[model samples]
Target: MPRININLSHQIVKKFGLAEVDDFGTSPEFYFASSVNLPKNSAFANSMKSEVEKYSFRPTLHAPFMHLNLGSESKEIAETTRKELQWAIDTAAFLRADIIVVHPGYTALPEKKTIEHTGWLDNALPNLDFIAKYSEDKGIKLAFENIFDRDPFSLLLIKEAIGTSNIGFCFDTGHYNIFAPLDMQDWLEALDGHIYEFHVHDNDSTGDQHLPIGEGNIDFTSLQNYLVSKEISELPVVTFENKTLDFVKQSLSRIREWEFLKT
Candidate 1:
């Protein structure tokens, strides 16, 4: 059965001061902001890690965003992205999280449209190779997310180019809504054997709005039923990736009540 999880963004939560992500009431620290840097064995990681372990909620991680990126066109930026991902992976391992979500890349080409798919492949393969190898050694699966990007094809192309078992996919549902109109099933099939995680959220027709589960137009019931049927063997980590904690928590409450019911 699918389980409720949070995407720890402690800074955002601290700003709002709303607790419990909504009334459905699961611990938000581990699910959302659990992987950020905290004092080593000093009260912080221990306290939050203990909170999650006590609850027995499965943990998943969203690596630092806006700060690091694996697919930066510049070498220095790319290295920073790689290091941040390594930190997130190491922290997830410490917390016993089975999965980590990462944005696969931005355009390796400054002019993505001018380049053919083959040329883009030439540029991204080495970076994917490094991340995939690092993930294998770390024993944590790495999932490249599909953001509504500036590229021409899709991140799926990169997934194919660096065809290694350690690398997988996390399809942000809002991304499809933002950039394309394909139904979720079609998106799932396109990802096929590669999908390992998900960022479940809703959005306005105009952009990646990150609205509550039902507040926007997505059909969560259908998506939930399909995921359940697949019995995804990897313990797929579903994150409520949104802008605000209260709103995200509220959306999670509805999801737990209707979609991921207690089994």
Candidate 2:
């Protein structure tokens, strides 16, 4: 059976408090949405850590992704990206998190003719290599997530280039539904051994609605069947990305009915 988790941002916890998280009945995949939230010594970090310890919840982490590009051509930007990612890994270590998710730092450009010509991967490789090594040293795994990717090729190339056991993929269902030219089965097959987690949510195929599981057009039944067909003894961690408690509850109820998940 898969371990279930919910996405809880630092901003949300700070604004609302952690008490409500108990109602979700799952471990949290804490999102440090900004570089400012990655400092390990901050009062907020300490307080959050204490609360997590008290609850005895095993956690995963989502690293800061806004305005940060691991593939930036500018040397200064690359350095800053590395620093921020290192801070994320350090914070994850402090929180005793096993997996920290990050974006692939790829944004499709209209002028770029090919994936290689886009220059994102070439520029990002060194930084990715550094971070993957750092995460491994800290006993933390890095899950590179799909954002604007039209297919799984880029992520596959990244996994091969980095060539590290600590690095894997986090398949974002909403992004796949929005941006992918290929089907979910293609993605699962291409990324077979590389997938470590899932950022699961629903979308209308027109936008990233982050709706409850059955509220959108995504076929969750097919996904569940694929996992079962593979006979995967252990399933990837499923992190609900629904933005509201009600939506999350709805999604949870829906997933609970899938017999494969109940095992």
Candidate 3:
């Protein structure tokens, strides 16, 4: 059976009445915890490490993206993002997480100021190099996710420039619904062979609704068919990025009931 993971935030834990880290599912995707609780050599991080060992769970991480902007035009802002991401990388290493998810951090520039003129590559590439190397040294993979892009062009460019095996993609379906001007299949086609994970959720194509599967306009059948066509060596990690545990559970059940996925 394919492994299905849920992205755990404080809200989910509260709703589930889970008192300990081990109460998380066997495959846990840890979202960024409260920054106030995260210090250098954080006990919170240590407890997570211990829980992973105790339960023998395979873990993934969603790095902190609040106020992080790797492709910012401001030098200071970019530097701060780099530092915070490095810290996230360290935390992931401590937890022995296999993959750390990140946002691309590039915003659409003014019509005249293209990606080149805005220093998007200049700011993002070096950070990618450093993060990719750091993740490699720690035996973790960095998966850059799509957000706010009308097409896959920016991600494709970043992939081409970096060209590191340890660097991969985490396709977010809800983000695509909200932002991508092109068809979902186009994004999938462009990202084929690079996707290592997924943020699976539904949306109305006008907003990131994070609805249960089949409740929105997303063509999940096509998504399953696309996965079936891929010749990847391992099943990509499928994370239900939802508002609540109940919604995530509903999505999981719907995923299992998909005709193509059942095969």
- Scored by lDDT, the top model is 2
lDDT of 1 by residue, 115-141 (tens): 244354465566668767777877878
Largest TM-score belongs to which candidate? 2
Error of 2 at 123 (Å): 1.0
Model 3 per-residue lDDT tens digits across residues 1-263: 44567788744543442333344343778787434445767665566677678777777888878777887877787888888888888877777778989986777545434455667887787788888888888888888898877777677777777756788789999988887667878888898887889899998888888898888998776678777775545667888888876787778778878654566
Model 3 — which ten-residue stretch has the worst lDDT?
17-26
Error of 2 at 179 (Å): 0.9
Ranking by TM-score: 2, 3, 1
Comparing candidate 1 with candidate 3, which one achieves the higher lDDT?
3
lDDT (Cα atoms) of all candidates against the true structure: 0.64, 0.83, 0.75
Name the regions of candidate 2 deviating beyond 4 angstroms: 109-114, 229-233
Model 1 TM-score relative to the real fold: 0.78
Once fitted onto the true fold, the runs of candidate 3 whose alpha carbons sit more than 4 angstroms away are 10-26, 33-36, 109-114
Question: Where does candidate 3 clash, by residue pair?
Answer: none
Prediction 1 global C-alpha lDDT:
0.64
Encode model 2's per-residue lDDT on 80-134: one tens digit a residue. Answer: 8898889888888888899999986768644424346688889988998999999
